[model samples]
Target: MSHIPYVPASTRYDEIPYRHCGTSGLQLPVIALGLWHNFGDDRPFQTQRDIVRRAFDRGIFHFDLANNYGPPAGSAEENFGRILAKDLAPFRHEIIISTKAGWNMWDGPHGFGGSRKYLLTSLDESLQRLGTDHVDIFYHHRPDPDTPVEESMLALHHAVTSGKALYAGISSYSAEATKEAAAIMRDLGTPLAIHQPSYSMLNRWIEEGTPSLLEAAQEEGMGVIGFSAMAQGMLTDKYLGGIPDDSRLASGKVNKDFFTDEALGHVRALNDIAAERGQSLAQMAVAWVLRDQGASLTTALIGASSTSQIDEAVGAAQNLTFTPAELAAIDEHAVDSGINQWWGVTASR
Candidate 1:
């Protein structure tokens, strides 16, 4: 199929709201698009183009990526680069593109971790794959237990100071690590702009610990963008009738034990609450994470296989408020279900 000329909707910024990233002057869409799953080479390119275009049309200007997003690793960024060249190139100034390093991207000893070499080299490769001079936000991806926090943060400082990335971020760091990283970045004069973590109704690890990751980000004046806000699709209505033949759970990509009777029971109860609030379970989950529950998140990073999923996620911004009773009811079913894969990474520090 041949592609037509791209023209974004003139009313693109009419619906979704943008929130300031922490205390910074930069603002991001309350709901952003993440290419962690669907933008890989395995998926049809047309579908990826449609989803990304629809997200931009709906006012979601932030697009998230990483070095290892695709099944083959780096395919997501390459694919997204194609999309950028074909459709979004003209609107580059309006988009917020973020990519990360720190995960394994190559086989050699220097392929992974928070060391300056891997982080900077991976970022250069990311910029190449992204077809851009600089990303709006550059993240360290995760905490590296072996590398000194100073080394990792200094690399990020260099990323910004050298003009490869406009701002610096860290993902999956614990409360203590986040504070230390933020302090280092502050001392370096770059100042960590954001913290990305896995957060959903079922994976509430960010809400754990004495200071809690949320509180730490708040104190450091760093914005929060939560990934896996839908708990890898488990928080959606798809699992209500048991895993469908086409679902991620049925494909063995997600652990089968994650849908234990206990977890499903909680999901079903949460679904009822969503119904009462005139929202889908997925919408409720997104809203719950974006709500001002003590330490509010600036944005919720969402992945979508279809255009309608983008619509559903954007709808979350319509009802971000939760009464005390509604929050109480949700808390009952939102117990941790051992769904957070990054728990060990955050706890490693």
Candidate 2:
């Protein structure tokens, strides 16, 4: 309960493995908790607190958030701030908090995009809502087509240099844009630290296209964190029989068109592979993203609605290896399932 004094598990560090985030000295849990869903005001506050507490107990110190994560927008951050104030504030030094801007967060013209005014103001607001003076990483949520990439990178540079954010990150960026952004940040002396891309068994955009986003991040010496590793729960077993009444698809949170019969067929095949490997489909999906495929990702960002999901995701670190045969089998069914809605925005410029 929120009223009870909280104490983290002493064996928390021993529960999961940590990897260096790119070439940086900073290390992150192989699986980080994402507040993209279920942390909003629509969910019960107690349920939110339980999930956060369970994640930390499982050794997930990294918490990823964004400005427009809630149905009302900004409520996820506000709820997380309350959790931090009540339970996690004492362990702040052990936590890595990250938040992003660049998405539409307000109604006015200057409310969104990569403009310095918007990004800077959003960071200040995020800090306030997070109940902290700084975030470990501040990201430009996506590539702004109209705004020059230079302007966005400069805003992130300012975020780090001004001590409001210790690092800079970009999400859903094309490989070319990633290179350009990384160069600008490098020249600005900020050195872009991470790239968050949507990658999963069903959506492999980051690995498609020339050079691939994975290669670009590795080449630029930036860490890679793959969000939606479970493909908006498509890669999980929840939809195998059919969309559950309580599922995201049934709730209309995700595109109904994405779960075409062809895609579901591929999912079924992948689920078989996971079972053969003695893991759940969700666990396999997370591990697959963290697999040491030439350009190894630094971490897998998973959105969890309950403590069980957090446990399954963190358990992914226990077995990240895949035999050549396993990889070959997965290749047959890991084809893109038309679930990447962000591809248009990412590849726009």
Which candidate comes out best when scored by lDDT? 1
Where model 2 places Cα greater than 4 Å from the true spot, the runs are 344-349
Give RMSD (Å) of candidate 2 vs. truth.
1.5
Q: List, residue by residue over 1-349, the lDDT tens digit for candidate 1.
A: 9867899999999879899999999999999999998888889999999999999999999999999989789999999999999999999999999999988999998899999999999999999999999999999998888888888999999999999999999999999889888888888899999999999999999888889999999999999999999999988999888778988787777888788899999999999999999999999999999998778999999999999999999898899999999999999999999887785254234
Model 2 earns a TM-score of: 0.97
Question: In lDDT terms, how accurate is model 1?
Answer: 0.92
Q: Which stretches of model 1 miss by more than 4 angstroms?
A: 1-3, 344-349
Give model 1's TM-score versus the native structure: 0.97
Task: Supply candidate 2's per-residue lDDT for 152.
Answer: 88
Error of 1 at 168 (Å): 0.2
Model 2 per-residue lDDT tens digits across residues 1-349: 4477899999999998899888998899999999989998889999999999999999999999998888679999999999999999999999999999988999898898888999999999998888899999999998899888888898999999899999999998899889888888888899989999899988888887678899999999999999999999999999999879989999989999999999999999999999999999999999999998899999999999999899888878899999999999999999998888775254234
